[model samples]
Target: MTSNTSAAPRAARRRWATLLALFAILLIGAHLRFLSLITWDEPSSRLHPDERFFTDVASMLHVPASFDEYLDSARNPLNPRNYTKNNWYVYGLLPQTLTQYAAVMLSPQQVLPACVNRPEYSDPSITIGQPCQDTSLADYQRKIVNPDLAVPKLVWLQQALNAEGRDLTGYYEIFKVGRTWSALFDLGSLLLVFLIGLRLYGRRAGLLAALLYACAVLPIQLAHFFTVDAATGFFVLAAVYWAVRCAQNGGVISFGMLGLSIGAAMSCRVTLATLGLLGVLAVAVRLLRRDPLPNGQEDTTDRSHTAISSPRQVVTLSLLLAFAGGLALLSFRLLQPDAFRGTSFIDVLPDERFIENIQRISTFVSGEADSPPQQQWAGRTPFLFPLQNILLWGLGLPLGLAALAAWVVAGWQLIRRGNLAHLLPWAWVTFYFAWQGGQFVTTMRYYSSLYGLLCVLAAWGLVVLAAAKHLPATRVRVPSMVAGRGVAAKHLPATRVRVP
Candidate 1:
């Protein structure tokens, strides 16, 4: 068969391969997340310290539908606080609100506050100073934290709470509902990794990236906890992907999508603003390169097809981007009546809160903050920590080395070409490596968000090696223009070449 004659069949084969790869990766993510979900024994287990923060926020972020419900939550002695932590408000609202709604649907019932009332004192022998009272919920929780707790008082408390017709399983179930969605987010990121690779390279690269991301330990670990990291990571990648797409297309709507994605990521983790910075940088490159909009036309006849080459088109795209960013800022503001007060979102940089946050993070990163015992040793080996964590066991040795090399190579090319679409992957790796490596006191999972991107780079490294061995069989295109000709952006077909 002639080479060009089989192009259609090859493309069809690639599509099928992509579908199969997606199914396999999704299956792996789901299986690992499921194991994590069921591993904790409910009766004797406690949530992670951070998880407690999320569930509480989830509960509070959830407004009561009825007055009675609101009163009950307000009156709870255990609750003891409002959703007023200024620092939390920075990353508040979206994840907590979304999870609260999910939990409300998945777990309709919960134990009443009175069910965990303070214990009364009563001595069995009426002695002057014998320990005689019901334990506090905080202390009681501590007693049961050990999976092997043999304390009869803990068992008695569970039995007592159950006898009151409380929905014993509902609390954990509600908390777990957020984690369930997080697994789905992890899966979504895996899918994006594949698509991004397929967009940039070819089917083999896409499949390889998807497989590596699915098998990576940190992503699997991210799925186990109910926190912003899973959602933030997914959206951060999504923002970068869409930013690339928007730059290539120059569509106003696409640019708006990029902004919303950035907002979503930031809303979950203010720290994720670093990830959004890549998108911003890429978009700036798109403007500086004078990339033409989707509809390229010189005349005022077709405003929609205006090219970025024109000043008016640049202004138009800028306005669209600003509108989207404003909307995102409004969302955060609405979450708290006092958010930003009279100040505009642009004022965040000069705001005291923002400055304080920066200083707080600086102190924490500089080994001045109160860190756990494990983190104390991290100060000794800052740079090597992330290198070992992400690239070594996390990605496997060969894959890790290839990915690291690919990041370096891709970064150099970005410097030379100044291509907007290619910048995010390189920027993502550099930002994380610098941030995480410098911070030192963190787990491998801290770098989990960018694992999908790293896998894409790793897959790309393989493709580059293959291209060298078979030079004539490969082509790369960045999708420059597609006007009246309607030439859509598509990948060059992946081909195999044999060398003598």
Candidate 2:
């Protein structure tokens, strides 16, 4: 009877620990993303410029029925014909359209065409999305802001505000609603980081990794606005998780999940396909090798992962990957017809617009290529991004440098020692770092995806270094303790050393 009672309590304790860890991530990540999103006195969200475009477009989803009106309203409201014609249609359509439709669903069916006050009187562009002076803007308040009618005083104030044209209660509510979704997705990346770290490292390492990502300053900086990068980072992380799974244990379901992750990433931002390519590479390497290496899943941590042993598994996984990719392409074309122009999924890049984007990204990555003043890359040394920005700025130099050293050690161990298990992770960090470092201009936000994985590595390295000690009168120390100037190992060895 006592044992049974103790077992129940233990399970409850485990459940609570998991909940607390997840909630802590949510709190820290959400705060970073939504710093000052709402205030006790403010009526609208104080989001970034990208956020402003999303918020402003809530009024046009019904008036114009095209989500592409965002740029036109802000930059070319007077020239409605040339509004969406510029750069509006060039971005990832799903996120913006989702926000627009969600706003419309929450708002009234019939919203008045946003009136433009010409620049002769006032800059119409500045006052474009504001409530029109002639229309009874108050008439549609009921559909826009859902009132707490059970509270009489609140209902009365809400109704009174709708009467005034200056009261943009509907528009405010619409954007606020949209920002919630963005904030959640951005914060969701943090949640996944915690789980990934815990699975690879340990509980303490996971917590540290989650904190590193939450306060790292890059992800947080971009998380403030609902943008393609933020969404891409989340999907990329998802792909990383599935890739790790495929590496540790190649299975049919893992490939399918990877497909979904890659599809989602590409659908958000085409450039994110780079990570997907790495994922496919990871799968191929896993299949070809007789002794497939574990991808961080074999950590001393508690999770037990699968391994591939049968020929049937390989064939099934391959077919599922193709199925998932096709489904993703079909969905993207159906929803974003304008962007695809009836082109096949593979043909999205050949389109004139994508060619321009290719040139732009090329310019951004390679300093030799001429770029517009606004689109320049910082051209900083690649290593400094993680060492200086992530570890030094956030965690202080002592521990931060140790983390960087750890990453170097791992890479060396993989290359020289032939530690095949880390191939997937090494490829991810290497490709991403090469791309980011080579770029002529980069932002902290540009590093969010790579940053998440490095945080995991750094956290794992920190914890291992902190806990382990050399045995008395030992001739050899742990590789990291002596990994100066450079090197992962002499060869990728399978032997597990007991240094203690």
Model 1 agreement with the true structure over 1-500: per-residue lDDT tens digits: 58878898988997787788678877876777667574554653345656666655554333333322222322211112322442332343456656654443332133322222211221122221112133655455311121111112233543443344332224454466677777888888888887777655556777888888888877887777777778877887787677666555557666666767776776666566555465466456555553233553321123234345567766766676676576555544433222232233333333344345556665765678766744655546777877887777778787789888878766654554332335667777787778777774666666777788899888877765666556645544222222222222222235322111
- Model 2, 200-277: lDDT tens digits are 444666787787778776666565555666777787888877776665554667766777777677667666666656
Question: Residue 30: error of model 1 in Å?
Answer: 2.4
Question: Model 2 compared with the native: what TM-score?
Answer: 0.66
Maximum-TM-score candidate: 1
Candidate 2: deviation at residue 394, Å? Answer: 7.4
Task: List clashing residue pairs in candidate 1.
Answer: 295-305
Give me the runs in candidate 1 sitting further than 4 Å from their true place. Answer: 1-13, 40-44, 52-91, 109-171, 288-308, 334-362, 371-378, 417-421, 470-500
Indicate the residue-level lDDT of 385 in model 1. 73
